[model samples]
Target: SLIVKAISRLGPVARTGGVRGPHGVRSEGAFLSPLLALLLLLLLNWLHPHPKALKCYKTDSEASNLTLEGCSPDKISCVLHFRIDKSTGARHRGLSNCWNLNDKCGIADCLYTPHSRIEDHGSCCCRTDGCNLMENLRLVTSPPTATTMPSKGGSSQGNRNSTSKSSSNDSGSEGGLFAKGGSDQAASVLLFSLAPVLAICVTVVLGFFLYTRHRERRKSRSESVGLASYPVDNHPFPVGHLSSHIRLKERLATGKFGCVYIGEDAETDQRVAVKVFPPQERGSWLVEQELYSLPEMSHPNILCFIGADQCGQGPDLRLWLVTEYHPLGSAHDYLAGHTVSWIQLLDLAESLSRGLAFLHESSSEKPAIAHRDIKSRNVLIRSDLSCCIADLGLAKKFFQGESIGDVHPQVGTRRYMSPEVLEGAMSFYKDSFLRVDVYSLGLVLWEMLTRCTDAYGAEGVPAYRLPFEAETGSSNPSLSQMQAAVVIERRRPEFPAECQSHQGLSYLRETICCCWDHVPEARLTAACVAERCKALRRLPVSVAAEEARRRQQEEQLADQQAPAVDLQLPQAAVINEASAAASAEELRPLREAEDAV
Candidate 1:
């Protein structure tokens, strides 16, 4: 029928393009020959007898009455299986034919329903025809006993003998298959048995972690209670519960981390600077606290730490850092309104350098520290005109044999960045980090000098300007602008020529120049700069004394060079000589009278 349809579809094409022989004889049989052959082949397939397929009683579920069904031509073997639901005590039996005669036969777990758990399932498959029809399909809990039946083509007595031998061989194969299934069951059992143990171990570890965290929190609370009960002394300041004694006053300054406020200790009534950090700034608060809590950290040139505390909960939580307050505020603020005398400038510079040197010094209990953000705003001016370094949030502490390379990269104000730091080529050594601080300190010194009345002469002090503000035209310059000015252009803060006229100011200029040198190794150490400042402090007194002696020598030399007038004494000179001679004679008489008596 398909061949007839193909010929009918090509009837028009065959007629329009009919095949012609060399002698012009039209031949239509050539195209029809292939179609006729295909039709004959299909007819022969329908007439020929097919090989016999397996006959089996097949059903997916247990049926009260089952009918034998013929298997497909490809299926040569039969299979029968039964499953029992452990939860419901229901049973299911199924029979099907397989395409291959070597289909494996064994009782094992089987998946039946989609998205359903596998209950107590057991399935058995076999290769023989009608094997599913045997009585062996009965529900026997133990491994199914292999059974054999006679083939249709053999004699009854001969088939019986062959069935006996095949049954024996199948029994051994079934035993080995059951043995593997037993091993698999043992492995599953073992996994389930250890589940509780693994769960217990994980729970214990998590509980221990929680317990340790709880204990640390409890200890912190206890310390806070102790601090509130007693007056703050030399011990480490507790970092909790501050509202009880500390009263916050006016806000002083605000920064990226938090705000600084003026506060007072209720019991002592001593004013202090309270730095309030938000919850997100907890890390910075802790870092500053650790820096201040170091042993022997208290110094005249360093900010004095009082105590720290926390208040509120969650997003509303605020961390408080209390320290000694200076009414004069930061050096930057002070320099904005007032110019310092030469002596005052020297004093501020020396104190700042001393604080930095102390921070860099290491002790048995404390490590050397590098104040990464060393700027005028971070240096506070005390009422006594001295300066103390503050705001150690970016400070890096180095223990013995520790490398400075572990610090975060390029953190600080852009305007005061060093050449190496600006170019991002900073070396990761102790000295290299310290030099970065020195370069920033040099810019701060320039800030102080620019506002020094003595350095600028009668024109008085220049308006307070940040380092490189003139070149960048912005107080807060971008990183690229700073890099261009400090690294590419090699520009630094300007030094007035008038400052060089004074010996002390000239030495200060040299010190500042050395500190801000492009070469990190060439910069002066904090200690060295401090010593130079001390020398400048004493310079004025020594310079004045030397001037006095120089003037005295000049006057005596002028007297000696004066021309002499001999043998021509004035009347006033002669009269003075006679009166001196008379007075001497009377004194000589009085002396002789006294000796005789």
Candidate 2:
């Protein structure tokens, strides 16, 4: 203060010294020396100005990307977009609406980065072009005294104020730039995280599509094969060509393999039977074709194969098998002729034995042949009344010397199945034919002996009663005194008046019963049965008795078919003949009941 005063007073003296001479200059030097030193100290103080820290605390209105365009001509309008420290919500408003909104200045384009330091307030002001706006805009509490801030050079002070603000802003900008970069980095990280999952999802979808297409192709191929719904003629094979030049006459029968039509060849005009298989059932037909080609099928009792028709791409086509056509049908149909004589039954059994023996034994060129599914349906008759074995579809030809017991465990018709087969004890692949087919032959003999009596046809008859039912009754007896008519059950057959004199039928009865033993080893072999029948032929049996039975049976059947003419009744003669047949039919039910037990 003293130095400034001294200098102020020296101003007058310095002007006088220039007017007066070197003597006035020497007097003013004493007073100016202290002032000169003080002036030097003050100049250094100005060089290092006291640090002015102006904390521009941001209000809600100062943090937006605002512009001056929205302001009225008299006021500056600007917005602030920011959040307060520890506040739950953000603040946005026009800065122009603030108290003491400085008319000389405005702020524009200000924004805070997300997650910024809310403690540090920031603001910017845009000045009108001609106006010295925002100059001395500090939050000053008190106006400085004349000595505290020199009144001279007012614009220089304004310049000093602006320089301080510019420095502060430059420091704040470094933090804002860092915050902006961090926000961008977070977004990029999120995108990278999902890339692998999306790639895996796309790969899985493509793989499933390709797999489904492959399965569709395979299913289409299978549909062309053996679907049950397809018709016989609609098969992929050419039917017209397969049946070309074949002339059908009468229908023999319809079967699972298809229709069997009796026909004649157009070229040779020879009578033949055409067995056709339904398209979907071609598997059985294919098996038959292989059986026909077997080398051991030369037996006279077996049906002969003439030719075969194979048409289509795979083994699953319709088959038309050609063979010699006979006027007579299956044994079941032939046996429908009222009654079969014991002599006729013995002859049928002998023919069957010959055929079965040929199949069971091995020859030099071929192996043991098994007709696995032997049944009454497969036995055919000719016009000459000779029996033939047909339908060899289930036949299996094994190597010579191979045992039938070692074959697959289960196969063949259920009724004729041996006890070993029922128990699954026999393996055709392990045991010889004598152990397997011989047992079946016994059952076949039993069937021929019993025939299909009406009593048994009703579904619940024991097999043992069949023999006693065949007896001719010569007397009427009480029911309570009767025993099992078939003595094969280890029970005695009660004597009937009609059958008490059947002494000549004892050998044939013994032969049929021996074949039906429970144990396979105990059963008679087909060969043994055939030999016994041959022996029986040598016995001196009256032909007149057999002829009489046959004639009587035919007349009974004719009477049942249509009404008889009115004439004198031959009651006694008719009664004598019918007594035996009536007992046989009636005993069939009792025999079946015992077998079930």
Candidate 3:
């Protein structure tokens, strides 16, 4: 306070030079020199504020609030540092975030009310314009590169120049009494004219700096959270053991579950594919396979899992499941790598149907497993262009002690969710349980048919529209707008013109449409739908020929390699055998009944 008062008192003297008291003319000049000396000393102290100069301070708890009212050009922005103490709980952490205004509060059109709650982090920016402006701010700026001030000598020299210029201008106007007002007016006009241009440049540069700082802060925050939160596993896997378990020789596929390495077991010399789940999410891993997925068994078309190293939560905690390694990889991956003929598509359709049919049959220990999530990405292809289902996290069993009537209510994939699921009516009815999976299967078939279609037709659909459409209305939106139209207004997907041209494709398209019908009752069961797909198209000529035939013809070409030997079917096959027989019996009675009808 004392320093502030001293600086203010000296400001006028520094700007305006005057002689000392006239009574003592001899000593008047001496008095003027002392007063000028005092004025210069005060000016230096005023320009360099202590709070801003202390940039090296680690924390900013003591800093005063920002004062924009009488701010000079030099002190345009005030910045303070803060560190979150981890001893504080999660709620406290949230509050610290609020205090920092990391939620983008207190900016643009903010109402002056104080926010007191963590949940209200963005309360100050609740006004529509403020939120929009904040987004604009994020888009515009790069960040500041430096936080430190210029050297003391350079700063002092700048201050001196500023002080000298101000004194010179003031003395010139006052000494030339006749031209004083006109000169002052001219100077004021010049300063005013240049101010806008300078302000614009500064604003642009500052905005850019602020934006960059925000981005960097966000990145740093994310990294810090990941480091602090993700507990270090003493056992990260090496490339070799993981590859061997999955039977991955080369990486055929990599996904959220883990990498699918094409591998061969050294002991059995048997080729296999390995799927190792990440170290995280290990607790519920077995439950996912035994209860949710694999309890219900297989078909030739379903990619089979052999042996599993269900080592729980250690160096081997990464749940490694092995399966037959298909040399051709997945259907979607193959399409990406190379184009497929219509014949190949037919083969894929037939194979996937066979797999789905096996899943839908009710003879397994558990009720039939529903591959609730079906998409082109989950379809794997064999060397002969046959496809099979993979990834059953979203699957559910509905038969055993619990009936489909008792199935838990939940939806599957977003894009492939059945109308019933979207409408939140899944599991309400016994029949609708498997119907959801059937609907997803239909969506997968449609996706295969229109693989070349852009996510939505060319109409520029905004992001907000797509989810809403899919979630609600039955009527389809325009083709161009479909992709962007999410939410309750998602439009129905259609068959391609090329699909319509093929006679074999008409039944396939019709079957898909029926399966995806808005009404659950209208959709075909997976078994019936699979049969329909098989009835429509024959196996491609290339794929139908026996392996021996290919071997003889392509003696020069590599013989069709043996199917992956690692597929251990003792558990799955044993179960599948009993189920297949039972399924045949159940269908036999129904078939006899139908024949009599």
RMSD in Å for all candidates: 26.1, 33.4, 29.5
Tens digit per residue, CA lDDT, model 1, 417-464: 898887889878777888899999999999998887656543556677
- C-alpha lDDT values of all predictions: 0.68, 0.49, 0.48
**How high is the lDDT of residue 55 in model 3?**
13
Candidate 3, residue 135: Cα displacement in angstroms equals 99
Off by over 4 Å in 2: 1-242, 248-250, 279-283, 311-316, 401-408, 429-436, 450-504, 543-597
lDDT of 1: 0.68
Q: What ordering of candidates by lDDT runs from best to worst?
A: 1, 2, 3
Clashes of each: 0, 34, 38
Top-TM-score structure, candidate number:
1
lDDT pick, better of 1 and 3: 1
TM-score, structure 1 vs. true: 0.54
- The residue-by-residue lDDT of candidate 3 on 497-534, one tens digit each, is 53442334554677778877777788777767656555
